[model samples]
Target chain A: MSLNDPVDDETLLEVRDLQKHFKVDEGLISSLLRAMTGSESDYVHAVDGVTFDLKRGETLGLAGESGCGKTTTGMSLVKLHEATDGSIRFRGTDLTDANEEEMVQFRQNAQMIFQDPFESLNPRMTVYDTIAEPLRIHDIRNETARVRRALEFAELQPPDQYFDQYPHELSGGQRQRVAIARALVLDPDFIVADEPVSMLDVSLRAGVLSLMERMTEEFDLSVVYISHDLSLLRHMCDRLAIMYMGKIVEKGPTEDVIEHPQHPYTRSLINAVPVPDPGVGRERVELAGEVGDAIDVPSGCRFHGRCSEYIGDICETEDPPLEAKADFDGSQKVACHLYEPAEGVDSTRVDDVTDTTAPDDSAASAND
Target chain B: MATQDEPSIFADLDDSTVDESEEQVNRWKRNLRLWRETLGEQWRMLTNDLLVKLAMVTMAFFMAVAIFAPFIAPHQPLNRQYETDAELIIADWVDPMFIDSESVYVLGTTAEGFDIFSQLIYGSRAALLVGLLAAVFTAGIGTLVGLTAGYYGGKIDDTLMRIVDFLYGMPLLPTVIILVALLGPSLWNIIFAIIVLQWRSTARVIRSQALSLRERPFVKAAQVAGASDWHIISRHLAPNVLPMSFLYGAFAIAWAILAEAGVSFIGLGDPNRVSWGTMLQSSRAYAALDFGVWWWFVPPGICIGLVVISGFLIGRGYEEITNPELR
Candidate 1:
């Protein structure tokens, strides 16, 4: 995706070809030697090329396993990590090239909720100061009243009770609430909640998620929820986008992606989640290899190395673009060679697909 | 849905509601209460350590001597009496009243008849002045360098850290002495030299902390909250790194005191000042070690050792607070 794509009138954020690559710092002597030798520095392509769009009051789930760059994509939305390349057009302004003045305006409108509440809230700042900080930064008046309202909004009753309390004094749930309050105090139009309840107790997860749901509705906010937890994503997100090694392999409505995952990577991920009923047996397509280092990502298809249904040389030689398959509806997009258009009728590819479909067609072809 | 109505486990923790009446309390009383609530625990932890308690007592005593030196010392530190020396009297342990009824020297006098006790009392003022002032300046410079290096890391971090490495490579004492000699011998010059030499260690330590602190989620959250680089460094990064700054500041005091002593002992100290190092230097020149004029040299040597040790003990005590893993 690039800036040439048409934007919808309701779109709140349009990220196109976003990429963030971090330089691998090989110690002092090695770097110096490399510099002297005129060797190119190596980079870890954490987020290779991510593109997505969110409309007003929409919650898009970014689901991937750990180290898949979902968090990096989330952070880049708020300009916490400047995109090494590509454009993040929030509202009408391109955030990647925003100046200080524009960045301040953007920052006032977009906020982020981090994954770990323990580490996200400043330990030294009181709950009141934590919530009041953004107000003070924006030069908004009546900080005390807004902070108190935010506290009450987060369901911490009697708002004043938490004013003087520090992060260490609060429980995990309460700390997350304060973090949410801080994010909401600005009355931002957009928010990126990066696994907001991942670090909390399982018992308290629902409360926090429900609070976030209420905040999104009441404040009319656009949210991007990034998580590795598929169950949580299914529960909270309206649409789901599955990521694999810094690239979005599949994206569609949440229920469609969950029930009818098209990509091999997404299929493996869904199969990996255990079923509670012992009587119902499910086939597990165990992937072959572990996730490779981002410094040297696999060529062709990033997931081809671990794919169970390795079809032909095409999967090894040609990278597949993310597009809607000929068979599936246009809303669901998948990046896999198996779903290529019918016009490219190679005999070897046809034979391979038939052979692969013989055993698993009953279970895998249910959506078809 | 039933669980939603149930009182949360945290309901009991909500008892300490903010009292509206307390807002009307006097500022002095409020500040005092604030201090007790915030710093009182750390102070209690420090005092609980026996070594830190001893260090605090020793430091307090030295500070008292420095502050009340004029009223406490019986004679002026620079006063000398050469008139009674013609008799070729080697030494007398008697009070100064015997020779001159109006004068009193508790620890007798030096070879030039300068008052030993008065010099010892007055010397602490210079030692502490250099130590405390150098410490404050070193920590300030170190914090700024570290905060800048850690926050804007990349070429800026590389350049600042390389400078720290260069400073770290120099031999501290000789380098400080050379700089002090070039700057001219004075208390401010010595403090300046000590600051230049000692700040690198604090800078390096704080930079590593800032390196980690800048990556912390809270700092990133602060960045997302519209904080500028200056705002993030001063408000988020600096406060988190402050306890470490203070911890290094204590160690910087010890280093500066020793550096000042080394400079003064080499005869580069301020000529007009009566520092403990100058006292030892003058006594050495007069061959007090061989002549057994213990009063002239021993007090200054012991005083230097006591103050440096006190500073180290306090620093060690603070280490536990900053890094609980050390405890």
Candidate 2:
């Protein structure tokens, strides 16, 4: 319901200042080498300062290019990756601070569906064993009835046909359905789907997406759909959040964000989607800039180095707080120096509706 | 063609055009082709390599010799039938299919005038038993330890791996011989010794294999599904880890058999039981290497070589099947 943990009673899950940092070179030899080099600041800031909320039965898309930490954000919510810092209140219970036992209890309520269906399902297990796994783990229904119900839930009709079948015997779509069945069989309240349809064939993508959309409504499940594909996100998500360098840059209602992307990074992401028809050519904003390394995130706004609206030193020195703008709907929030009232800029005079085109001279393009 | 309307390209053709009476004649050809394709894939997977087939055949031969020793053997392994010159008498090697004289020893006699052929046959059962049982227990212990170590990882993995390393660094065969000698020979003592030494190799191999399997997303998926540690190891990790562990387990059988021979040759084996090793040890003129007495040592020695060779073959076949990189 809210991207930055807004004060609202309807919000079912609220994440604030979430971060998942991993230490590099932990092995003895690697540590020795690192110690000699004095590279103590060897932390991979995988997900930093990410905040959001999901209302009950809402589908919020966490969109980002690869290595932008959308997957990490989704994973951290389910306590798959231990959060380095921050808090996640799932309907008022703190998920970020929970220990292993507590997380196991959290796991029953929240589940994750991974990207690669082929890699996610155990190759050795039969379809029944695979789907029956979660049910057995949580000490749920009778094995026979549970497996059949899960099989039916995932749209694998006539459970007897699939009961003894192994993953290698099935097609990619069926395998993904098995993965979904494994996730959904437990009947969790929240689901984090990390590029669930990305690895699927283009033709099969719709079927899987529609099945998930149908599951969200059928189960009344609050879902976080993480994907790099904006078009896919547009179809699947009610609200969308675009991530850049381990932080959410812009987020709002899917239609509102697609129409009026407040952040330059969000606009560039929307512009990057290749038009299907060869005949039609829209005015495209080509983002020719070095994507910043997440490890060495730029001091100010991480996007300032490549921002199309190349403002003064304020963009480089100060990080902009996410604030509501009047030009678009009041609900959408963006964190950019150009949109918000900041040092050295009169916010009222700034053109809020114009295209923030990349300048002709490429000097301001990310040199990092 | 339809009148004015086009016939759909996607429409199925009439069966008469593709499936005529000629199909009956070609049925055998079709069946043969299908069989060949299936066999081709299987052959590449398990038997295309000459060594694997040789291993399989060798194992089969040894198994048959052990299992049917009583029916096949002409002379009793422990009985000496000679009235005089019992040590010097060598039975003329007779064809196995046609042995008329019970007095004529096939493949000559041992130092005690007991038939070498009979001893070789009786000896095979012990070799096979020690080799296989040792292999089974070794792999079982190794897989269990490796699974726990890999799945639980951290202090448990470190402690178990350290124990493995401690065992690994020892002079294995000599230590085993000394231990077996102390424990005293019988089939079980030798087997116990072999298992203790052999399992480390298997455990190390399986542990490394399981370590890799632990990181696979399927394992993590199970972890997230709230599957307990035991469940994840047994269901998700164990299946992928099984083949490699079996590969090492198979090879361990060969080594265990060889080690049994070595211990038995050192006079540490139960002399009451005749094995390939004991036969080698008890052979007349075996240590002296005398002339015109080739039969004294050659049969049992050859049997030992064959058994070890068979074990290697079987082990390697398992390796080829289990290893993905080789495939």
Candidate 3:
């Protein structure tokens, strides 16, 4: 797990310090009519210096609140959103510099599953055609065969019955299964599934999640599963990264991070997950203020404004670098001053373990 | 031991069951069935709508007449020398006295010996051609510009939107008049004027839709699927925007037809070709009111009203078909 352990030879994808900044501008004439209309401009640093690597057949969960840039980071990996800086190496080929043709080849190996079941499938396309579309684009001449294979992989039995079905005719879960089938038709090795089950009903969500889980194993697929649902991430991911304000606040083995989160933001997120046990009541760590805009991220630690345990000076003036906490098995990393070893603070106190309790069985899991 | 070692016939069935391709085929077939079901639903909704059915009938009738104007009309309107002269063309076809002229015109005759009924029938050909062609021109140009601006955004969006603003500022009627004067009063010239003057509105509407559609999860899905910009625009974006384009195209055609008539009424259309507007102009010039010749003005006015009203009805029908929220 250490950085020097000859970086996993099985690593299928690697993202290093990726960033995407969108520039907001004023209307056309106002900006053009006068050289200086003083049209104030701002940059939304959607994915700011996010770094991660995906091992072959491993599911790395990107858990974060909305607007934390997990989706943007996922997009940058496939060259969907052009990265402002940094390198995305897919099978050792740098995606940041890959021309359109190179990216097309890269796409054969990497694909994506979107968040919404309602809107993700093209309404104009039938199920058969929707799944066949990728095969056509990729020049898979045996489109019927490939589509059939993909639909099978998605577990939609008696595929003939649903071949001509449109999105609206299918239930929410069925639509998502079709979306997954479309993605799987290409036989891609890697996938960025951005909250693929977020739009489904509670009952249907588990079915899609389980299907994805089974497919991941059956296909030997490497995936970056992005979602704000911590429990679901626990169920599906091998390693999980907690993102806050477009930065990875903490990341490690799923069990390790959830059981022992080093960053205060990660701790708060873990604390917020409701437990389903009647005997024990869980303590909630409510976030202090609203999330600051991406354009004006706080100076030092982006979470300083919202961190309840913030120590004034260092938290504001100096940014904390992502470093390994001692208790972690060398794989875990956290970016917070609280985890940083201090002169007066004892090493044991540095962990700052919080009271962990299970929630009442009667309490429903809060929707993220 | 022999029985246990023997291979079972059901092994082949099990193999087929586990065959990945077969499973996929089944899934695909199921999805297709579902899609057809949805389309069936949409069709049922469309058929049940009274307004939609009416519009469809009106459009079908107009288009049929426009297409077969030569065969359907008793006298060829464009062929002025066809048996009927102006006096015979508009006379009542059922009357023995009118039919006795042997130059039978189903509708009637104009004041200047031109066939009023024939002219009206032929005039439809010109009106429909201009309206349809102008709509194509406007929709094509507007959709291209709007898609690029909304998709790429930033500087391109700003610049394109400014151009739209400038066009919006200009008075459409005066601008069309000036352009027509410079370009000369021809049918094609009039169509060109209508397209140029009207494209701005289409672009504005398309841009607004594009702005919203561009952000949809499906658009993002296409992007992450590694679809090129052209692929995304044509496949993902175009299908979503097409219904809107068709809806707006209908409205644009209506506008173009009105503009064509307006120009012709002002005596700016092809001088040789007969149109409803020419009939109006000539009727006014001849002082129809003073002579008590109601036939000249009334027939042409009624033709114009029928076309415009039908166009509006058809456009409404299309809106209902594409927009489920409206239904």
Candidate 4:
């Protein structure tokens, strides 16, 4: 039942303890105000701790609301923001310690697809230059053929038509396609798509997402598709990892996670998704509480304040570890006290295992 | 509702409008539209700003003077009344600003017995040339250095910015004069001094611009694509910094002209030519001020002022268009 077990299916990237925190030096006046208010830190914990595995020829969806660190996790995986502290291994080579030469090699193999299609492509550059750039950089000098190939792959057919056009002239969907083409030109094995279709129109979103899905099989690519849309993730991802405030609270096979979300946060997110029939209202966990500030993160469970399944002092004092749910036998993982038998909730119990340590047991599903 | 699903209101439009097969015409129209969208916006702003419009007119007028110097000049600028003082045809003592239909000396004559009007016209050419050439060179060098510094942060940024800081602390005009004085009077040397002092401001401004732009997602995407430092700087940073380059170029031209005028005014100019600055210098040298010959100095000074002001206006107009907050 544990599909997430560490299978020997050609692992491409293993991102562990990925953290990217930005210091906010908000002037003398703000410092004075902070001093008076007794604030602890002046840091934005953008990606406090994220851990995930990317298998070759697999699409992993990172789902979370805005400011939940999904994008940050994706960015740091490619060393875009420079992981504050973590290890990212590519095919067993530790990328976190990679020198410039090695980093360049890593970049050649792993490309990034940014969120904003319109803003990510240089407005001044023609579509040819945008796609041709990666080819030129990686020393793939046969530019015309490669750029044309990439363009075709991105489904911008009649490559000649789009070759000379700038980003402004292209439609939003076309622009995103060009971005995909730019990422594809290098023939990279791994691609981190950070909310790739988030800024795209609802009508065009499905097309781009499916194109990404098509790319996985075509190129044999290991892709991390980061988005907040559960439905979109359902369609695109083989495995899903739901993040909340810079931590992955639940992760498993996409279908299983969507069907039976174990984490309180994941359940709320799934419930929030609009159903076609208005009368079939969701028995949603109506979370109504102040979202905790990133700088002043709450002790114990970060989600305890807004969690509907507030397990009294246990939820408040002991931050729940992401654990493989007892009944599912490691297929579905949830980070909440309710899943722990020691915390007195046999809500979704199996009675198969003893109480396990938090950190050692699960930072991420081992996928063994 | 879908935009294409809606029935076309212009069903009865002209044949040309409906002809989708006229590909060449359509291509030309597209080109026109793109050009109009980019430059037309700036052009519209230029015309809209009263000060900028006035500046453009003034610049056009002076540019015309520079271009038509050979034809408009009443007499050759180097022309003296005599090869030697003994054979002087026009007297130095002739009334200032005296115009005569019979003589080429429309603005009378200077103390050197050279036509003042001719000198002013010819001087326009030097002013425009130095101003333009210096500004162009400055913008080019500054932008290149800036792109390198900003795109490649840390040591390169520190070193280049420190150099700019060093240059900034130096009194630009005074140092230029001293350098020119040492190098001797020549147009190229004057240009060299101005350029050395000129590009610092452009570099500093562009460096900051490049810094902000280097952080943009597009640039990061380029980095993720395995683009080298040179590739990022040239392809990404340079193009984005172009609008600012233009803004600075105009301003630099104005400052260069002023700097040249100041240099020549202090007798550190190309002694062979009669720029507006040199004309003023000559007036002082000949003690024309002592003789109450006000016409000799006034024309050149006004020309320098007008040229510099025009450059400022044009630059400001450009800045307004490029900077959204300013607009």
DockQ of each: 0.31, 0.20, 0.24, 0.23
**Mind giving the per-residue lDDT tens digits that candidate 1 earns over B109-207?**
887777788889999999999889988988899999998998889899999999999999899888878888798999888888888888898888888
Give the candidate order by descending DockQ.
1, 3, 4, 2
Report the CAPRI category for model 4: incorrect
- Alpha-carbon runs more than 4 Å astray in model 3: A1-8, A26-41, A281-284, A327-331, A340-368, B1-108
Docking class of 2: incorrect
TM-score of model 1 (first chain only): 0.89
Best model number under DockQ:
1
In candidate 1, the residue pairs with backbone N, CA or C atoms under 3 Å apart (3 or more residues apart, or in different chains) clash, namely: none
Better of 1 and 2 by TM-score: 1
- The TM-scores of all predictions, comma-separated, are 0.86, 0.79, 0.82, 0.78
Q: Quick one: ranking by TM-score, best first?
A: 1, 3, 2, 4
TM-score, candidate 4, is 0.78
**What is the fraction of true interface contacts found in candidate 4?**
0.43
User: What C-alpha lDDT, on a 0 to 100 scale, does residue B294 get in candidate 3?
Assistant: 68
Model 4: per-residue Cα lDDT over A243-352, one tens digit each = 88888888888988999887878888899888888789568687778668988778777898898767577666666666555544446667776763233434233311
| Worst 10 contiguous positions by lDDT, candidate 3 chain B | B1-10
Residue-by-residue lDDT tens digits, candidate 2, B1-327? 111222221123342354434544454564466557645864677777787788788888989989999998887788774645655554333322234455455666555557777888899999999988988898899999988888778899999999999988877678877887788768888888778877887777778878888877788788777777788888788878787777777787788889888878877877678888887776532542453556656777887888788778777766766665665
Better of 2 and 3 by TM-score: 3
- What is candidate 3's DockQ? 0.24
Error of 3 at B248 (Å): 2.4
